[model samples]
Structure formats: C-alpha cells, structure tokens
Target: MKSYSTRAMALIASAGLLAVAACSAGSGTSSGSSPGADQSLSIGLVAEPASLDFTTTDGAAIPQALLGNVYNGLVKQDDSGKIGPDLAKSWTVSPDRKTYTFELVDNAKFTNGAAFTAADAVFSINRVKTAWTTSLKAAMDVVAEAKAVSPTQLQVTLTKPSNGWLFRMTTRVGAMFSQTGVDKLATEPVGTGPYKLGTWKRGDSIVLQRNDAYWGSKPFFNQVTLKYFKDPTALNNALLTGTINVVGTVQAPEALSQFTNNDKYQVIEGTTNGEVVLSFNNSRPVFKDVAVRQAIRQAIDHKALLDTCFAGRGKLIGSMVPPTDPWYEDLTSVAPFDLAKAKAALASAGVAGTALRLRLPTLPYATSCGQVVKSQLEQAGLKVTIDQLEFPAAWLTSVFKNADYDMSIIGHVEPRDLGAVFNAKYYTRYDDPTLQALLASADAGDEAAQTEDMKKAARRLSEQAAADWLFLLPNLMVADKNVTGLPANAITESFDLSRLARS
Candidate 1:
C-alpha cells in the first residue's frame, strides 16, 4: 500500500494547495519520543465533547480526525481546504453548476462488511439539512437538497450556484454515515476510512485499529487511541510520561513553546483559516447601523487582544472572509483601525453616548472576547456589559436561538466552505435577487464570474460590518517527534492520526 504520507502528498497536489496557513499547543507531557511507541498510538483531546456523531458537533476537531477511525466522508478537503476524492472515486458537476453527480468507488465497504454506496452520502446530507438538533453545519444552509439516484450515484442540488457548496460537503458536517450503521449502530460506529473503531470504553479511551480493507492508502503503524482531558495540563503530563503517544488539541501558546523547546516533540502548524469573531444581532436596533459597528471596531484593538489572550499567536483579521483566501478582500474602503474614526462614526450615527450591554460566550474559544471588547468600548466612552455564559442552559438559548447578546464571541472551526462560516457571520437573507445573481454566478457557474461576485460579497461583508471580524486563527498541532505524516493541512479534518508511530 502507498504510505499515508504519499497519499496525502498526492491528495494535496490535488486539493488544499493554494492555502498558505498557527496557534500554540497548550502545555502537555511528552510520551514516547519523536517518531512515537511502536505498537499503538495514544492521543489526547481538550474537551469531553457531547457526541461522537459526525453530524452533531464536528466532534471538536481532535477526536473527529481520529474518529475517521470510524467514519468517512464521500469527499473531504485536503490541507489546502480544497475538495479531494474520498469514498467517491470521481464526480462531475452539471454545466448549470447546480447539480453535483458523484460516482462511488466500487468494492468499498465498512468494517462490518457493509457495502459503501452513494446512498450513504445522500442520507448524510439529508440528515444534516433536516435534523434540527444538530450543531455541526449551522453555517451551511446552502444545500437546496441531496438524494441518491442510483446505488453508486448521488446528486446534490443547490438553491443556486454557490462557489463554496463543494467545500462545505467535504467537511465533518458532511461526513458520510452508513445507512444501517446510523440507523442501528450510531453508538457503535462503522466507517470505510483508514481506521476502524476497535474498542470503546466509556469515560475512558477509544481504541482504533487500522482498516486493512480500506481501498486507499493506509496509515503506517497499526492502531490509534484517544484519551480525553478537561484540563490540558493532565494531557501534557501524559505525553511527557510516555503514557500517551500524541496530544491533538493545543490551545495554549506557552504550552506550544514548552513543547517546541523540548527536543522530544515536533510541532505542526496549519491554516485552519478559521476565526474567533465578535458577532452582532444585526436585527438588534443598536447593531443595525454601520456607525455603531465602526465604534465597536474602533474600541477593540485586535492586535492587543491577540497579544494578551492568544500569547501573540494569531492573525489580526477585519472581515468574515480570511485575508489569505483567494476570495478575500481588504475593503480598504471600510472602517480603518483609527479609534477617533470609530468614535466619530458612532457619533455621526447617533449611538456613541448610548450604553450598550452585551454577553460574551466564553466556553467555545480560549478567552472571554466579550470582556475584552467591553473594556475597549468603555475606553471609547460607551458603557458596556460582559455577561459570561456556561452550560446547556446558557449556551444555545442565549446565543443562537435567542440572539441574547449585544455582542458575543463565536467559534467557527474547519470552515473549509466560506459559505459555512460566512452565512453565520452574514448573508442570512432567506431570499434575494441581488444575492441570487451573485450566488448563481458563484456555485459552479463560472470561476471568473464567481470570483467577481465573491469579491463583491467580501467587500459588502466588510462595508455592512456583518460581524466584527476579530481574529483569523490557525490551529496549532503539537506532535511527538516520533510522529510523522500528521503534518498540517494533510486532510480536510486535518492531520490524520492513523500514520503516527513511536520509536
């Protein structure tokens, strides 16, 4: 079999190529050495996530990547954030750019010997679009519908052409699930990927064995194990002690520095091209006007925030679309970083003296962005409030369903599809002719036309101040020196853990 590394190289040559894309690994103990233990790979995660289901939460980036051990997508993004073939051996887009017809690879099957077919992809997309309880693809509302036309063919129709529709389908939210497996064995998952779930010990660790049946290239070493840690310190300690072979989620810069200084570990940085943004309820009377948006932008110094909270490891961003992306725009015409301009803009809009109260969602991201913005607003002479949130009660109701904040920070990770993140940040109109024309030209219609529309959209996103684009962040992955092929942007899920091996 071709090594996973070679496969990744070929896949990258095929996708995620244009990306140039870092955060620090939180502190941890190194287990094993550079190159990792021989028999099994042990990994760590930052949170005890709510679900292992792909459609639920994107599974917190770390575990979901390993969970490829048990789940697979028909198509997935390569490191460059470009779509690459997965279960689908090949595909064709309609000339109109609205229909995507996929042809499944023959002889593909899950661990349980169940055949992998195009029907699974259709079922997965439908589940995502129709399921009300899922949090995975809230940003992806572009799919008009998806269905299976034949055993090996699936079709996805969009309301209109959306340049980002393809990328969105390759995400975790779009991971293909076994129809029978999902109906009966969701708790006991099965996937046609590189690895298979070997054992699940509740509240403990999950073990994954290499899937010899996988049709594509496979990982080098045999198995992978993921351990959960509420606090990163414990996860790091395990790495240092050699109890755990690798740690996946690195949220602390100091931790990354510590790991880098040690000769025992290798740090992998990739462009997640995701952001931690401070969003506004545009429907809210105060945030509706562009001047107030300018004031909020003026009050918060993104550079200062990055230095203070992220340990100076972050990209200062100003819009929903990442500046590095081809579709990105500087919108030099939008509000500048000038504090006086912010204040003057607010005064002209007649919202400067008004006290604006907002709540900040803290659990998702590393810091309380609300508190940070609150201080900035106060400095700008506007009274501000930062209400900290916690738990099932505080999270959904207060943030999404209720729009319960004057301002709040939201986490958008693995947004390979700009539409997946952009919609949540802006463009919520249920229907519009102008947006329709732009999106039609975007989807699969024409690259030049789509690029032009996307450029216009990016500028409009900034001019409208859709969301105060706070920080464009890169995910920092710290791997033991023993680990190889787990490089950044290697996969859509990023860093397939199946290949890591200890010395």
Candidate 2:
C-alpha cells in the first residue's frame, strides 16, 4: 500500500499533466477511452459536498474528490512526492524561502470563458484571510501577501519559512478561481477543469459534463453523475443492481465482505489518510477532566476496533497521523487497554458512573464503532449515550463547527494536514501553547526538523489524552466488473470521474 503522503501527492498530481497522461490513448485500453462512442458513468457518492464553495468547504471526502476536477492549483505533486507544475507551469523560490514567483499557464480559462491569469491567483489565495473562510485562515497564516507581478506572473511572500507550503498549495484552499465568478461560486462553481457542473438536484444527485474547451487532455467519459443515498443498504443495493457504476465509500465490515466476495463487482481496498477518532470537545464539563479522558482512552481497545469495526482492514493509529505517514510515532502502546486502569481513572475523576453524550454521524463505521465503544466504556463503568445524527448539514452545523457534543466518533480524512485540527480555536477545544509553538517550529523548519517536531506534537496530543486516537480508516471502492480506471489509492484526485470507463 502507498503511504498517505504518496496518495496525497498523486491526488494533487492529477490536477496537472499526470491525469492527462493516465487516460490518454497510449496509456491503456478501456471502453471509455475508445475512439468511437462517447462513454458515460454514474457514481454513488457517500454524501454531497457541504457547499459548492471549495475554498471554504469542510467535508473531507467530497471536497477531496471534487476539487481537483473543478479547480486548479499553482503546483502539484507527482507519484514520487516531488513537486511539479500545474496551473502555474513554473516557479522560482527565493533563498530566504519567504517569496515564491510563479509563471501561470496562459491558455487556462474558467468555465465562463474568462481568461485565467496571475491576478486571479492573487485574489483567490488572498481570499483565505477574508471572513468568508475564517475557520481555514490558520492554514495559510504564514502567507503575508500575494500579488500579480505581471499578467502571467505571480508572487507570494510568507511571514516565515514554511516546509508545508507546497503541500498546502495542493489543497482546495489554494485553488485559483476567477475573481469575477466569486459571487456565483457558493452555489455554482466555475473553474478551468476537465468537467463542468451540469445539474445538482439538491438532495438527490449531481451531474457533470465534459468540458469541450478544456485546455488539457480530454477526459474519456462524456458525462458523469454522482448520486446520493442516505442509507448504506440502499447505497449497496444501488451498486448491486448496476444503478450506479461505483459506490464511493464503503467501511462496514459486512458490506466490505459482501463486496469483496461478490464476483460480479470489482472491490478495491486501500488505506486512506483518514484517522478515525473518538474526538472530544474539551470545553465540555465532563471531558474537561484529564482523568475522564484518560479513562475513556484506556477503556477502548485499538486492536479490537480494527477487528470489529473494520474487520482488520485498517491500521492501529496512536495519533491523528497514520503509521504510513512520515511524521508518525510508535505510540500504539501509549494508552494500552486496561479495564482496571480505566476504572481507577474514572473513579479519580469522580465520573465513574456519569453518562457522557457520544455524538455520531450517519456513517456506518461511526455508528457501528459507537455501539462497540458504548459497550466497552459501560463495562469500564463509564456510561455513554449514542446520539445518531443526519449527515452533512446536521453534523456540520452542530457537532463539527459548534462543538455541541461532549464526544463524537468520526474520521479526519485529510493526510499530512492534521495541523488544521491541533488548535482549540477550531472545535477540538484542546489548547496547549507548547503544542502550537512546536507546530510553528515544524512548519518553518526543513523536512527532517518538520518530521521530528510533528512527531513531538503527536506525542504531546496523545499524552494529554486530547482524543482517543483510534484506527486509520481504509478507502474501499466497490464498482461494477466492467468499470475501469478506478483510482489506485484514496487521494484528492482518486475519484476523478474523468478517468473512469466501462470496460
């Protein structure tokens, strides 16, 4: 399996020439790639993008899958994790590592037929600091200024040397958008990508059509539709009946088994950068006690979660970063499962028999894991009430943004970007000046120093019992046997409908 960073690199790489090379005529053979007929596809999305505004969107899966196809960034990363050119065909960095100058691709144009230039890049990146995306401001906090040096040239100055700047550029927050289309982006996004948004039937489905005027190599499929199914059973049924060519997310152990065993389907399983966690809202009265947090961490079994929740498909994670990631630390034994230790901690915290609210979104894995955790914590003398929620809107408005729950079980899906959640200012509410400082050092240092500091930060978070770090989430794509060009790994670009085909 490729590491999470490697997967992210490929995801960003697809925003550049790599995607064109992947589906071009000489690359391979598939029904969609054939010269004669115009191919089409229907995909079942686990959920819709929270909003069409990619710059401020928070849902991990849909944004990662949709951004690369709908928007373009200045730089991209290759399979080997080397930085490459994307919308900005070339760039030069100053010795101080604070200023970067990029040469934009002149041929690129937005879906509205407006030309793309350095001015658009400047406006788009600078938009991060605006009130529209306040939650994501920290990610680009180091960027002091961005300006258009010329029609096709752009310059960006940073507050400090940032090792992760290029990685940050790979995210949707850094994607360039036409300044004129800013008003319409929230409802209908316009970008210089392979496909144009066709129709979005609010809760039902989204349709995308190939952009005939696209600057890069043409995608194989003429049209692609992403359907949404609220129930996992209904989603599975859609796939089984061939109503949809692909089922985007499938984490249930039984569903995984059924899909893998069924010869009629092509089941692809691999590790995503997503880390499933029993996240805590530290500001809450119950979680404010360190002993209570430690007790909950000790009560749950990481290995058993892998076995029960995922059927041993994912890896045991000690922290937010997965083991496959470079900055990961071997802290799996940091909080071992011990019922006695858990009981003692709960007793010390004076919450041994107190009922704690455990909020869970509608995801199958989360609901299933919540049941297991409820039982384990109950056995350890900790009471838990599972509050299941409707996805996207409910979770986004309450649990994620408002920090309305005491504890919740969900996966943080972006890889090499865990820094976004480390601060108390953004929902998690576990604040430590030492951690923030260490992360700052990591962000400014060289690759080795960054890795070391990140590891230290991860250790600090785990030692504080900030959250119960659970198993790494796996990406499982179940498709019809005839479908082709399904992404090899779970990355931002893995679900690019443009690459798929009916073989």
Candidate 3:
C-alpha cells in the first residue's frame, strides 16, 4: 500500500455528459467491420488516474490503467501471480541468488521509436533508485548494480540475496522506460506494449489505441476506453445501456443481481490482494493501548460486517496476507467477535468511555463498513465518531500523512503489501522490531524459509492486533457475453488489457 497522495484529481459530477461521450467513443464498432468483430471496447472503472506517470504519483489507478497496456516490464505476473517473462524473454539466477541475468527481446521497441535493449533495461532499473519519488521505489534499493553486458543481455546484482526482489520486478518498479521519453512522463508516457495512449478526457475517460507496430501477438481490440464513474449505479448503468462492454471494478456489490440474472452479461467473482483494512492509528494515545486495539478487534463481527457492508462477497482474511499469497493462513480465530471480551478489555484498559474517531475515505466499502464498526464499538462502551473524508486527497492528507485520525478504513490493493502497510512510519504507525526483523529475514532467505518467516510475521501481526483485517475485496467484474479472456482473479495492479478480446 503506497502512500496515496493528494495528486489524484477528484471525480467531477457530469454523468450525463460522459454518457453521451462514451456512447460515441465506445460503440465497439469500427468501419467495415462485421457485427461480431468489434474493434473497440469500453470498460467502466471507479477511479481515474490523476496523472499518467506512476513514477511520481502514488496510487494504484495509474498503473492499473497503464501497466501491461501502455508499458511493458522486464517481467510480469500472470493471473495466478507467477512471474513470467515480458520484455526479457528469459532470465537466470546465479548460484548465490544475488545476481540475475536477463535475455532481452530484440524486436521490441518503445512507442517513442527507441529500440528496447539492455541499456534501456539498465537505465530503467537504475532510474527507480535515483529518480523515482514514490515509496514503491524502495523495492529497487536492493539493486547493487544494473549493467548491460550487451545489446541483448542485462545483469542486475543485489546487495544481498532477496527472494522478493524478482517478484517485485513484476510491479511498477519494473516498468521499462525509454531514456529519450523521460521528459513528459506525467502527461505523456513512452513504453513498449500492445497499446498506446490515445486520448485522456480528465474526469471522463482514457482511451488506449492498439500499437500497429507492436512486437508480440496483436491485441484483440484496436481501442480500449477506460470510462470513469463516481457512482456505482452509473457504472452498472453504463454496462446495461450498452455504453460500455465491461465493469472493471464492481463498486456496488448489492446491486449485482441486475447483472447476474441477465444472460447477455457475465459476472466474474474472484479474489484480489485488496484487504479492506480497519486501520487503527497506533501512534495516538488511546489506540496506543494494546487492550483498546484488541477490544476493537474483538468487538466487531467480521462476518456480519462483511455481509452488511460488502454483501458477503469477500474473504475474511485475518491478516495482511491474502489467500493468493503463499504464506496465507486462516487466523480468524485469533480475535473472534466477542462482546463480553471487548467490554472486559476496554474496562481493563480504563478507556471504556474514551472518545475515538473512525475516519474513513469516501470509498464505498469504508463508508458502508464504518457504520457497522461504529455501532459494534459503541455497544462495547467506547465513544466513536465517524468522519467521511474525500478519498485520495483529504484522506491521504489527514489520515495517511498527518496521522490525524484514531481509526480509518481503506483497501490495500498492491500485491504482497504486508511490509509496506505495517512499516514503522506508515499511516498505521505500527513499529515492531520483531516484526521488522522477521520481514527482513523473510526477504533474505530461501523460498522455504521465506514462506515460513512471512507466515510467522503475519501471525505476529494478527496476534498483536496491529490492525483489524476486515475482509479481502472480491474481484467482482461484469462484462458483456462476447468479452472473452477476462482474468478471473486480479493478482496485480494492472487491469491488463492485452489479454482481453471480443468473441
């Protein structure tokens, strides 16, 4: 979970204007094409990227739209979360596991017309440490050196053996950038992928056009439009009225019946790494007490909360690790919902009537879940207040950067983001030396030891009640019947457009 900065623009209220624009832009019809051979596609999404550049902007929306669509990485994670070759055709690890050598693809070229070579790979890897401003850049800090041995070969050596380094390369940190195109990354991007940025209408939509000179297999659609919607009903309506082909992120799960019952549409229900967390600001005096934190965790019934807030569409993951991770465990028994235990813990801490704030980002899940949390905690004899802050901007400022809230809720969507959220200086302000040591040990170990250590770290976080793991967000998507190659699970930040096709 990288720090979501205030840079992401707010969603403007002009649904009617967008409806007209989308109908013309996303008709999925191309000149001289037959009925079933649509050359364009439109997808409804909740969030829009504030900027095209993920190097400076800290949010998932940017990469979700660009990564694997407009940009290609050295490596990429598939639907199952396995690392596979992208620009780099193949790779090998040294016996020591500290160095990685890559075999580059010669035919690939950046959208800017620069050849994708080892030098560009080295430059991209090195730029992350020297120039990237987002917290995700730290993943590249392990690189001791990235050198190009030849036009088709690249080598990267780490300071130490890291099991997670190569996997992290599948993320935005690994996106290959052209040296000549670094000037306008925020407004214009250059990458070697199947699609190129076509048009971006702020507060409306971003259209990606197919690169006719693409190196690999041709994408199914010539154009893909990511249409933005502030309200979930609008997103659903966009699909119903034939304005869009797919709803990429289903915001309102309770209204899913409208799509599920229709034969013309297909509803995809899968899992994501998004853990809708009930975050407690551990730095605050009232939450600093372990008993208070545990009391809150014990008070809320996770199942009921999930049922009420999310329409019981997600998983009850008791820790930061989602089931997709290798080290996942069902730790729900750790702090089961118990009203008596919650009251007893609050009384023991002498903070029964202490006033606490549950500040929430204006995300659908947080707003819906905040009510349940307030009701449950109030029953446990704790005074609670709910504050709805505008997402990305106000929420990131007051809750994430300033640490001005007692409690908050936001979905941590980045893959395998346990280390980022629990970081000592992160918004949660949970600084446990033992947990840090465990994470460090996990990163520097072999595959077997890494999984064991990560499991231990997750267990430690759950037992200590670092934060209440509310529920893992379900990857609920609604697409037209003709849309093929839809990913069942969302294991990465990118809503990869390369695999989608029309039947």
State the local distance difference test value for candidate 3: 0.79
Instruction: State the lDDT of candidate 1 residue by residue for 75-110, as single tens digits.
Output: 765544456787887889887777888888877887
1 or 3: which has the higher TM-score?
3
TM-score-based ranking, best first? 3, 2, 1
Of candidate 1, the 10-residue stretch with the lowest lDDT total is 1-10
Clashes of each: 25, 0, 0
Tens digits of per-residue lDDT, candidate 2, 1-503, equal 00111111121111111111121222133743552146778877555555676455455544444566777778765443356888998998999999999988889899999999999998888777773453555667789999999989999999889987777786666777888887877678888887888887887888888888888767777788878776778888898888988876664547666777888888766555666767889998888787788888999988887788667777787787765568877787888899899998888878889888888777667777888899999999977899987666576657766888988777665557565665677667778888889888998888899899999999888888889877766666688887777654553433555556666
TM-score of candidate 1 versus the correct structure, residues matched by position: 0.79
RMSD of 3: 5.3
Listed in order, each prediction's TM-score against the native is 0.79, 0.91, 0.92
lDDT head-to-head 1 vs 3, winner: 3
Candidate 1 contains a number of clashing pairs equal to 25
Q: Report lDDT (Cα) of residue 479, candidate 1.
A: 65
Can you list the residue pairs that collide in candidate 3? none
Q: Candidate 2: where is the Cα deviation over 4 Å?
A: 1-37
TM-score of 2: 0.91
